[model samples]
Target: MRSLERHRDVAAYALGVLNEADAFRFEDHLMECPLCAARVTEFGPVSRQLMLYRRATPRAVHPLTGPGPRLLDRLLAEVALRRRAGRRRARYAVAASVVLAVAGPALAVLAGGGAGQPVRVEATDARSGVWARVTAEDRVWGGEVELRVKDAAGPRPCRLVAVGRDGTEETVTNWATPGRDARPHTLRGGTALHPDDVLRYEVRATNGETLVTLPGA
Candidate 1:
């Protein structure tokens, strides 16, 4: 059944393999299922590591000559090893989520007590059908940011920028967008400007077109 299949989508969602539609459906399912939410949260670290690795690697194809391809092959082998390890960890995490559920709220409260709530801003570009949500957590050095964006049409490179009140702009992070299948991206970046000093955040394309703008706290 479709509902049962949604239950099975936890791993695919964690691995970032689910298509946009399925991913959205699974996210909706998450609100109704705390166990799945806990599992997904536990799977977060490995998923982030995979995404970081992908960002570091080049997207271009190289000539089939000498050590270049060989080095790439070895890098891919290492990624495979890490992916297997991630899957094993995911399994263990699922088991752990079960234990936490049985243990009740005390443990969950203790685990989550470290950080205060982040300030969040959300906006949509109606013309482009792009949506973005930005959250900022203050730190001594500056501000840590996380962006969740969807419906950004692109086969081009994109970047997130934080605009300061004094008109200075800082490039938070950059990412390559998929051509037709534009799945949601969860990207983390930091800015030297404090959260209060940031005027706004913008998601811009390679051509410098603004897709979404979120005001700062």
Candidate 2:
């Protein structure tokens, strides 16, 4: 298998998505590849983050009272069992220093909003009719694209369009409405596009001749 495919499989293994045979194959690869092993180690932190969130948001126990200590205790027990099973897996140790070296700069950039930039698009998913978020410097509207206004002075009507790299475009605006905050709006009866393949999104406002385009296209 190619290195990228192996890495993807490693991620899937870390995410607990691999079957037994694939898991064995990956384990054998991990023994000889220090870099792949290190990448696999990143999953430890990801798993911990998942666990923390799960603990913070326990399942509701009572209709009115919500989750209680009993639920937390059961969750803890499950986590402990999983940890014990993980201990039996092949130990491809990744140095703590290496993890810190790579994580420091990544964390800094993500904290600075350098990673949260939205992609602008000219169309919506032909199947799903949902547009990806677009970044704008000021209020503007054009074509099938609509701006996600934080708080407009009055009610704003918007339409979403999904466009693919294959030159396929789908536009939906039948149920669009304005809101006080920016929330994901969906266009019904449209197929969802793969994140990697989405070319752009188109946004347009009601009664306006202009259209807004976000970067994805």
Candidate 3:
């Protein structure tokens, strides 16, 4: 039924791959269904591990053929469903082997501890009236940053900046601020600077005004 379809959305939700409307619906469903919510929690660590590889790729290249991220996402969910239904371990192993074969370098990076312990920091800008909580994780090539921002409601464009200890700056990510909905927005980006090398993170408006600044710890 419809509920069963929603249950299968856990993997995509954990991967942050669901479209906004679908994600909102799933989240609302989570409030009522502990089973789906628990599955999402179980998928969290794997989701983070995979996202490091995903974010490192260039945004310009959209592959038209071959198995892509969405395919991998669905595959993972299917594997989970099979396991939950008490399917044989051999089947799960085959599915997982395919994922590992496809994931290749990403699994190597993860196994080598390339994604370090995440550090989280929070800040509120008195002047701009913006509040933010940021989580920074060190990756082999750079750092992965996720921001939860609030109170900067608008149709305005905004960017996240990663400031390095050596005085260099990199634009981690950018998006338009959501209009009056006012719910806290979560955004993730990757930067070339190592997590330890980053001094701070800044949320900036299109006109170059700082909305909030999170000190990197």
- Choose the strongest candidate by lDDT: 1
Over the stretch 107-127, how does candidate 3's per-residue lDDT look in tens digits? 642221222347788888898
Alpha-carbon lDDT of model 1 = 0.70
| Number of backbone clashes in candidate 1 | 0
TM-score for predicted model 2 compared with the true structure? 0.28
Question: What's the C-alpha lDDT at position 82 in model 2?
Answer: 51
Rank by lDDT, descending?
A: 1, 3, 2
Ranking by TM-score: 3, 1, 2
Q: What residue runs in model 3 are displaced by over 4 Å at the alpha carbon?
A: 1-115
How far in Å is the alpha carbon of 87 misplaced in model 2?
Answer: 20
RMSD of every candidate to native, in Å, equals: 17.4, 23.9, 17.0
lDDT of each: 0.70, 0.45, 0.69
Question: Candidate 2 lDDT, tens digit per residue, 1-217?
Answer: 6666776786686555788777667665665565665555455446434433444454864324556569878877876765554454313223443666787765421211111123233333344333344431110111222333232221333444557788765442322234333455433222234333446656554343224454442
**Each model's TM-score, in the order given?**
0.47, 0.28, 0.48
Q: How much is 25 displaced in model 1, in angstroms?
A: 37
List, residue by residue over 1-217, the lDDT tens digit for candidate 1. Answer: 2878988888787676999888777766765665675566456556655554454456773433246558778878876775676578667767888998999877752221112346788898998888888888765446778888886465444568899999988766655555554677787777667687899999897467998898876
Query: Least lDDT summed over 10 consecutive residues: which range in candidate 2?
Result: 136-145
Q: Which ten residues in a row have the lowest lDDT in candidate 1?
A: 108-117
Task: Tell how far residue 15 is off in model 3, in angstroms.
Answer: 23
- Highest TM-score scorer: 3
